[model samples]
Target chain A: MEKTARREKNIRRQVLVVDDELVNRRLLGFIVSRDYEVIYAENGIRALELIRKNERLLSLILLDLLMPEMDGYELLEILKADPALKRIPVIVLTSEKTAEVKSLQLGAADFIPKPYDMPEVILARVRRSIELAEDNIIIHETETDVLTGLYTKQFFYQYCRQHDRYCIDMKMDALVLNINRFHLVNELHGREYGNRVLMLLADNIRTLLNETNGLACRCEADSFFIYTPHRDDYGELLAEYAERFRSAIESSRISFRLGIYENVDMSIDIEQRFDRANLACTNRRSTYTSSYAVYDTQLHERELYNEKLISDMDKALEEKQFRVFYQPKYNIKGDKPVLASAEALIRWIHPELGMVSPGAFIPLFEENGLVQKLDHFVWREAAAQIKRWKDKYGRTVPVSVNVSRIDIYDAQLEEKLREIVRSNGLEPNEYLLEITESAYTDNSEQIIDKVNLLRKDGFRVEMDDFGSGYSSLNMLAALPIDALKLDMQFIRTICSSEKDLKMVELVIGIARFLNVPVIAEGVETEEQYLLLKKIGCDIIQGYYFSKPVSPEEFNKLIEAEQKEELLC
Target chain B: MLTIDSLREYGADVDDGMKRCLNNEGFYLDLVKSVIPDTRIAELEAAIADGDLDKAFETAHALKGMYSNLALTPLSAPVTEITELLRSRTQTDYSGLIDTIKKKKAELDSL
Candidate 1:
């Protein structure tokens, strides 16, 4: 029932249309309005305005070049300039066949030749474009910004070299459109409304150009860029197009600020044109925007800094700058001194910046496809730590570690784990593998098979923080897990409310029935521990025992406990 | 860099500490409260103590909320744990759980 509700909630489809001709706009709108909420503009400029207005609801764009205001080329330049809206796949519809070829070269995802074939064909293209746009949105959200839908700065730079190579080879036209004083929007109406502005801007631009040749992207928090190749002498045509684009901005109900780049020195290639426009946009500070500037030389320097950030990030892992820390887990019900089971938390000990948390770097790593390296490092580290403990303690305690969903894609997860186990001279049974419920969703059969294989080898598997994922039953039933870690939230409830206590008690009972032990996490207080004990929780770990400590500190704790026991 | 005996000692201390927490009711309650919201306490307690039908609903909702938060998830882990028990409210294991809770509380009061 819940899944069904979620699916229903996810059904909204938004489409944008940009055209210089009113007839084309109305025709496209009439055809698509039934399936998607369609927004239209007569020129690329007006499309950008609509994009800025309704960014959130937009899914696909049908762009037409040769518009009077902001010709398709200029519109594309503006769209690609902003990283946020750049993912919206454009289907360029232009009468000019030469322009269609140029549009493809300019980074247009698809080009629709002049004149619609049939309504079915148009619908098919629209459907395909929407799918691509939605996929792009998913990619953007998982790895980039949810609001602007831009390639995360980390993701953008990570892909920079390859992207630049592709651009140069294809001679793609690109532009960087920076939104001046976007901080003011965030500062004024707050982030939510500012995001709305970006959405609105992106949606409007998406609709204004020939769908095949144009794209609007959110490049940064405040900056945006669009790129498109010029097939014909669009210099004169673009001047008039810029006016319409400006007028569309002025006509919008919301009081949004604006800027533009058009009619620059046109002799250069597409990338140079984008550069010129960005330069012109930057030079004239006093002119209240809704004014257009053509390409210029200044934009090159601005791009250099981005290139450097990307390059630096690329080398971050190879430099051996990352390290890990362990947090101890305590079990409340055992009436035994809490054993330290370390959660292998990672850190980047950047040479210059001191220390960086996984919270900061992990997301960046995931975006840039560097997470695999980090995962490998973590696995090796955990294995090494466990081995060290086993050599000393003789398998009396366990070490818990995290794994990412992406690691399963490597096809060597089981092999790697086995290798690490064998290399460390450690029994797999002594180490506990902790995984999130989400990981099960990625490749359930493979994950279960591998985990079960590990279990068969005597390794203990614990589904960490079990109560918060989509498929708990499936995970428990399919995988050979030894224990289930109750998330801290379950434990928190026991202290504050009866609702939580009942729940905890129930979980304990169920686990007991299944012959699977339950570990309540985040037991911070004495009362929570008491409640967990009452509920028959097999094990409990939290701050109520002790926070994570260093090996030295942990040794001290053991000595103190022994002394106390002696006194008793 | 570390000695074998010291590592064994560390494991023993952790084991003992974990055992101590198991029999302490107040400790469990406090741990639960710290991690969950305030609004759910009264109803959850009332349901568990009295076995009210409404308590089941309230208990289920609270468990769902708490488990989701702790797990940093929105799915079935913690809530499923409780719901399974709640569904089998008449099971003998449920009684064992309640007795465990009482014993833990007694331990904490003694402390």
Candidate 2:
């Protein structure tokens, strides 16, 4: 912002004298000649042309009341209408004392009585009007955003408060409309191009303010905050805005997410209203989901729930409240399903609430970056459980645990997992890692490099939730993985829908080509299990066999596996 | 070679006019001499004859400002009178006032 702040460099002392009479132009010019450089325009037409060229350079305009071609009064009206020229103060040159009132009404800064006579009075009036206009230009720059003529945030907030005085009873909504992934647009097109986009957005915002009668401010760089009387047509308005941006950029990449706190609770602070609206706007900002989100009752409750989860997370982690559970995965290649390995899952047993679903907290933790702590907790706990089973059954049964994208980014992640395995008295193969397929699609080159490093360290990495994202078949070839774990949603309707079953078959075919096993989860019924087994899916984990259960219950399966009757 | 004394005889307020030109007598008389010869004085007469009162008012008003600025009261007085009449497009015998302005202009031109 400091780099972009505009600076005024030139000194302003150029005075324009507009009069048909040479005596008056010479007289006024001579009076101000010592302090200023005078530009002479014999009539209003010539003066206007000079003003257009030297609008910034001019300090003041001394206009005569009458001239041929264009009179001072007509010129005054023209000057008053132009935004750029109107700021330069004009002092009417007149003999008629009665014309003074009309001149003032027509926007004369002051009047200089017609006469070449008083240099002292003439210079003083000229100097005062110029000084006042200069000061006003300075103030104008501060109040307005340099790129957009919209008010700067501080002044915008001030003006919004002022609006309360006039329309206290009107129900207003605070809206925050954001350009999603704007930095990407900047990176793709240069910053100057980005500025043009912002300027166009500001123009659209000006139109919105005109229609709704509100106060708008351009927030830091890529968003705008508008406080206006409640309008229930935001859905249509957002669509219109989206269309405008789409045509402007000539690409569908110009998407926006608008959040509104409708009929705002005035009891709350204004900033907080915008904060809630901003929260709603960013609800799925990272994902290509909804275009607009209102901060409604449900979203408000969810906000509170997320807040509570954040507050209680640290305490829960320290208190051993998170318990790791294992869902048994059986090798389906044989006649009888034999227990192969278990997938580690977590269940939060809150002291007060008794049982908090992982669905309720995992996403919250993942978004806020507390998932790394929870992931580390599950990693260590699952390793210890594997050791416990090895001690009892005398076999190193492998257990796959989730490795989040955050963990893959962690430089210490491989070392941490190896340390867990070493401390648990197990091999790297005994402690498998499950990396989500979607995480591979983002930062593929980097995550692939890290996964290759981990694979070199002798860890088997399974691509978890294989069909969940835009995993191009080309990308699958790039991912360094030991197995493909079919996303459970694919299995939900596999028996009913031929497309889903064929999709699963296609994935299994790809797995076979890669020469890796396919582990299908969420196979709940016999029909789904038989169909998956027929498709050459090497493993299965679902309620048909067992839901994720306590290690104590899983120990029973381990005992059965030791006796060679795991599941029959 | 219009001196301040001659300008005063032509009914110019030399002291006030001098004060306006930063008390410079040379500049004040120069302005008075310049005011009498302004071509708009001729334009004002032409516009009056043509019945273009708007154009007449513009020219008369300009003469009023110039004569009044130099404090050439004899010329300024009649110009101002006709200027006011032309201001509202008041149709009247502006000829008498125009003649008086012309006579004062000749008096100033002679000075």
Candidate 3:
């Protein structure tokens, strides 16, 4: 990287002249200095020191055969062994008649036979060696990625074309492999661990290319493009890659999603073929069951649909087509379930399409970072509603809103939320922030710092979808949250899946120990409600109580509770 | 003043030496005269007299290169012979070769 940074224009080329005798150094230095800046080293040790200091600038080294302490041959051996310094071409300046074979064997670039070159012979050889070595170094640095040793994207595409030239009528597949949630690897583990994962994947990718007669390049961070011979089925191959990768890394948390374009259209450019592959790979997420996806017409249609939705997102927000629905959460511990805070969920009503599921657009928006806009709109709407509900019912019922992973990552999120609360004549505690557990598990320290800051500002943060994460028990105790919302998936099969029920119980126990209430969502059946109530769940929200309804529908539920309280 | 002609009179390869110095005659001649005070010739003599062939080899090796680079063939010729002899760690008398080098260097200095 230092060498890469040193590759700036207008740097004067330098040559290191290593010789014990001052006159010999001066002689070679004079000749080399005509075309390059000259550096003199008295002996092998001094030469190595200068070489290291000026490795990036030195274009050539003029080394004498014999010296005191460390000899020229010894220095040659050391330089040849080193990957960084070896590229600087060395020309042995020796009068020794028999030193030619040995010097050349030790990796001398060119030899300037001594006594004296009548005129420009030595300088000509010096220039030639420097020019050749420089050309080689430039090619090497630009050809491969420094980290993965894979072809750089430009060179990858270049090599792919050359491959076609040699093998006529060769049917190749353009495949792009991407790591899902790769940032989490860098967050959950350290950056070093993340680099190790990339290196491991690259090594396996190299082997795969070798086997399939392919070429691959690391196109971007956590993204690689591979060009290989066409295959009918990539399913088994991707599985094998997954198995090899999982065993190599020893973590299921890290997964690879590969996109493939088989029998590529020879008419299209290499980059465009890979672009389609990348599109196909990203169409489905890592959360999906399949490891690899192949590009097809149907997939292209879905991409067009998604593109349409993405294009209309800004207008939808402006026209107020997105609606905020409130689902009532009940405190189930008392004699009867008491009305508690409700969760604010977004539902979009498109002009063309009557209703779009939150599941459809939320993920799409999250992928492209438009979720923050929708989330902010919801925050403003929900805060204003809380004010209106308080004035109508004469009681302040706090509402919990989804604080997305992206929203929490925003540097000004806390200030934005505080501004919303202040403008609405409500306390920060009246608006709860629901952040997903996966967010905490990804980058605990940074998110914890952000959450602690929000809590310090009197905002109650609840960890949403708690039981679904791969969070360690140690991390659970350290979380700065007011409540834990059990992931709905766990509650959906708690009675059927014994393991799921035990996980829920374990999480609830951990939650109780932390002195925070546990909110159970997706409690649809009576049995789920009774079982959750028996297990000391503090709050419940699902169809068993009420589905996510509009504010007007939710207002009736609040009114019914008001009448009961008045009668009591 | 050591003109290139005067140095050629003492058998130094003044033309070759100047060419090696990028055709600077004054610089090449000045470098040639510097060999008179070089001290390694004397060191080679002393190290050989002390029977330290290892030190003799090192000093002779240095003088061979310096003389060869400056194109002082008279001095370099003897120095190179002694250098190879010492390199083989031969027990021969190096006084003969060392004195020849001193005599050649003194001749060039007198020029």
Candidate 1 reference-contact recovery: 0.00
lDDT of 1 by residue, B55-87 (tens): 664455434433332221222233445455675
Per-model clash counts, in order, read 142, 4, 0
- Each prediction's Cα lDDT score? 0.60, 0.84, 0.86
- Ranking of all predicted structures according to lDDT, beginning with the best and ending with the worst: 3, 2, 1
Better of 1 and 2 by TM-score: 2
Candidate 2 all-Cα RMSD: 12.1
Top-down TM-score ranking: 2, 3, 1
lDDT of 1 by residue, A452-498 (tens): 77788787888776667666554555566788788777777767787
Pitting candidate 1 against candidate 3, the one with the higher lDDT is 3
- Model 2 segments more than 4 A misplaced: A1-12, A44-56, A69-89, A96-125, A131-150, A188-207, A232-255, A262-276, A279-286, A291-568, B1-15, B24-26, B29-62, B82-111
Clashing pairs in 2: A115-B69, A117-B20, A117-B21, A118-B20
Please provide, for model 2 over A1-568, each residue's C-alpha lDDT reduced to its tens digit, 9 standing for 90 to 100: 1311222243437889988878878877778886788999998899999999998788889898767788899999999999988999999977678889999999999997755436766776777787788788887888789888888888887887788777889999999988878898799988987888888888888899998898898878988899989999988887787778778866656767899989987777778888888888877464453288888868688778778878998999899889999999999998989888999999999887788899999998889889999999999999999899888877877999999888888999889988999998888988889999889988899999999999988899999998998888898877789999999999998988999989999999999889999999998999989988888899999999999999999888777666665443
Q: For all the models shown, what interface RMSD does each have?
A: 29.6, 2.4, 1.9
Worst 10 residues of 2 chain A by lDDT: A1-10
